[model samples]
Target chain A: MAALGFAALFNVPARCLPIIFLFGAVGIFVKLLLLLFGINIVFACLAGAAAIGFLSIPAAHYKHAPPLIFYIPAVIPMVPGIMAYRMMLGLIKLTESTQTLNYNTVLFETVNNGLKVLFILISLSVGVIVPMLLMRKESIKHVRVPFSKK
Target chain B: MDQAIKSVRREEMKQLGKVLLKAGTMLMSAGANTGRIRNTINRIASAFDYSVELHISQRALSLTIMDEEESSFVSKLRRTPPHVINFTILSGISKMSWNIVQDNWSSEQILADLERLEKMPHYHRWMVLSLVGLAGAGFCALANGSPMDLLFTFLASFLGLFVRQEAVKANFNPYLAIYFAALTASLIAGGAVKLGLGHADSYAFVTSVLFLIPGVPLINSFSDIIDGNIQNGITRGVNALVISFSIALGIFTSTFIYQFQ
Candidate 1:
């Protein structure tokens, strides 16, 4: 549902929505499963994004659309929005802090959240693109939409 | 006879160049990354026994198309249309390009197809708004927001996206539309916080505006830079930054008002 919403918001072709939903669900499930196993959050995010990127190749080949149209919307749900929100809020709080101790605490919290957001974003982007890099030859196969005639 | 044939060939090259430029600009403005644009266009050109070199920037595309012999070429530059995330067009063109190659389409046929692709309709406005609102609620749920927080997020984001659509229709700058949407979402969520209606008011406040995050542009920026499209990457990055700043400002404004009240 989250992926569908983003796919719609981005005006993704109607036909691609279900696939995006599947990929999105798969990504989140992977991230959560890895988290359950005590994996680092950044690595977890990278794994999830890589899963989506790999899924996108066959999907894109079948659908005759670029892999980006598939993976971009799916990856969005894992974008660490809450962390960024906390970082921004922490920044706001830091500005309002008076005492040195309070300022230091807020500053630390802000930086931590900010760095996490940064690393997660990097991992997600790199994860999505790595498959394309590794399988560039496979990604370029000709596609024919199964139901379409000429 | 030779002069006439040369003239006719040049005309065909010009027409093909125009078609390629139009397609490239459409893909670029529709939020396709640099590599896809170049690859798709190149694939289409190759079907016509020609090849192309594309120079893509943030808002423009420069294309040079050459025949097999490289005796003559057609070069043209066109400004990309405003960026709107329309994967339908991206998908449509991708499919159409492959079809062109397979069917051996003429430049005229490709132009006709491009025209048809341009007119494809988006999902209905209300559906998009409601679904995006629900998406915000979903995000809130993922964040462990309370049920009341989910309701607040849904309502806030629904109205916020509505405001954004209307603001865009009113010809407001795109960043300004985002600012307005953020302000609307935050204001509604902030009001709920003040009213003490939700156990996770802050969650609602944060997640309601999550819909406005420019996730695609930011991610595309990273991809672009990694692909060595540094100028385009930096431009998109800065664009996303400005948008984030706008969102933060709007949220901050509402938070300041409600905190004092």
Candidate 2:
């Protein structure tokens, strides 16, 4: 539902919504499954996004649309929105109070959440784009060139 | 006669240049990454036996289209419209570029198709509001908010997005609209928490404004940098950071207002 809503918000073509839903569902499932095994959250997100990225080529071929349309909204649901919010709130709190005790805790929360948001975002974007780039290279190499040597 | 041929070649170059610029602007404004935009334009130009050199920045595109013989080319620049996330237009033009290559479309035909695409309908306002609101609630639920939290989140984001739409329509700066939307959402959620309405008011408060996250810009910025479009990538990254700051300020204001209560 989150993916579908974002797809709509992005004005994705109506025909591609189902693929978005599929990618979203599968991506989250993979992440959750990895989390159940005690995997780190950042690595789990990476794995999930890689799953969606690998699936995007086939999905794009099937729909004849750009692979990006399928994965962008799907990957969004995995973004650490709450972490970003908490980080922002923590930063704000730090500014309001300068006492050493409160300052240390607020600073810790701010840094912790900030670092997690940064790494998770990096993992998500890298995980999704790297596979597409790899697969895309293979497809490009297969294109028939006129008068090419056998 | 030679002069006549030169003039004709110039006219042809000019026409083709216009077409390339139009296509580039559409893709850029639709939030496509720089590589895709460049690749698509190159593909379309190659179909017409021309090679293109393109420079894409955050606000404008500069294009030079040269014939196979490297004679009688045109160079043109066009400013892109404000960035909007419209994947339909992006996908439409991409598919059309492929079709152009396969079917050998004329410039006139391509222009006609572009005209058709420019008129594509967006989702109705009501649909976007409700769906985005639900997306916010979904985010809240994912954070383990209770049912009451979800309900308030839905209401908060619904009104927040509505305010954003109206603000955009009223010609406010886009960042200001985002700030207003985030403020509205956080205030609503904070109010619910203050009133003792939900078990997980903090979750609702934090997640109700997640709809405003600049996911596309942030992701595209990273993609652009990876693809070596460093200038474009940095500009987009800064844009995303500014938007994040706006959202944070909005949330901060509401939190500050309610924390003493």
Candidate 3:
């Protein structure tokens, strides 16, 4: 939540901060809950994304802003900075090591780290889009209808 | 009579196309994802009784707008740079797009609104810098660091941002700014590590650099690709990867120098 607040202060409107903060905290909780139930790491990320995506819809209506205005900033905290760094570090180490057999572990670790980051990203984006697609279809049905802050 | 009617329709198409083109460019400049940019233009066109054909690439946008009478069309082209994201301008444009979609205003009013928005001041620079530092500290806590580590991360990131802003103010390249900022931040944190200051974890050092990562480009890259915007997606993705590579290179250099000491 504090991470979300920090992000909101950087790129979001003051009035929309609280909702963005809430979306992130709850989204991470959803991820944790899925993990507790033995869900795969990729599935856990998907659940987290869906959680925020669902939460942001009503908030977007209230703020009269697009859901993405909040969604992207809120998700910043979860970006795998350490994993990416480790991937780079491992690759460098693999290159410097003269022993081919021992360096293979470094290569494996680098690829594994990169893959993990990729999967989490894929899950987050795909999960969020699923709800957005449904919502967009609903909006089109009411093309001539007047919009409300509600 | 038919020829006269077609010319009049063409004029309307041109007028509408100009406005729509401007909106698309603004959204792209403000870092809107590919999908949102396309949809916003579509919404605006539908509201105005035109259905538009749009083609967005890495460096340009083209739109063909057909008027309600279907008698004529106007096409527009704009060269674009994927400029840095600013939420204030983005929010203004978002509101304007909604208003346009709602059919609540005329072209004149929308352009006036856009004019004001382009001139609107964003948050104070010092405040933005502080908040960016705060974000780094928050990442420290998020990384499971101790309170001391959080404080250390805050101060390090604060100074890091100052150096970055200075580099930017001096008109250094964006990637260069990131490099200087990372080197400055991680160097300080590295000094702390050498001296074994506090109980702060080494993780806090990396948190100082997090604020400079290419979050928008990465997210937009995937979104564009998933939406089948292959060209723009690949462009954005490569752009992001380059920045990421820059950051990694910066960190590697700093750590490499530290090894010699």
Give the candidate number with the greatest DockQ.
2
- DockQ of each candidate, alpha-carbon based: 0.56, 0.60, 0.45
Clashes of each: 0, 0, 0
What residue runs in model 3 are displaced by over 4 Å at the alpha carbon? A1-10, A36-38, A142-144, A147-150, B1-9, B198-201
C-alpha lDDT (0 to 100) for residue B158 of candidate 1 = 95
Please provide, for model 2 over B119-159, each residue's C-alpha lDDT reduced to its tens digit, 9 standing for 90 to 100: 99999989999999988888887888999899999999999
User: Quick one: ranking by DockQ, best first?
Assistant: 2, 1, 3
Q: Which is superior by TM-score, 1 or 3?
A: 1
Q: Give the CA lDDT, 0 to 100, for residue B212 in model 1.
A: 88
Clash count, candidate 3: 0
- Is candidate 1 or 3 superior in DockQ? 1
Model 2 segments more than 4 A misplaced = A141-150, B1-6
- Model 1: per-residue Cα lDDT over B1-261, one tens digit each: 989987888899999999999999999888988877888898888888888998998788998988888989999999988888899988899888878878889999999989998998989999999999889998888888999999999999999999999999999999999999999999998898889886543889888898988888887898888888898989999999999999998898898888722
lDDT of each: 0.88, 0.88, 0.76
- What clash pairs does model 2 have? none
Model 1 pairs in collision? none
For candidate 3, write residues B1-261 as lDDT tens digits.
989877876776787788877888878877888888898888777767789999987677899998766666778998875475766667778777777766556667777787787677666777777777777887777778777677777777788888987997898998888888888887776666666773444776677677777777877787788788888889988988888877877788888977722
Instruction: Give the C-alpha miss distance for residue A89 in model 1, angstroms.
Output: 1.8
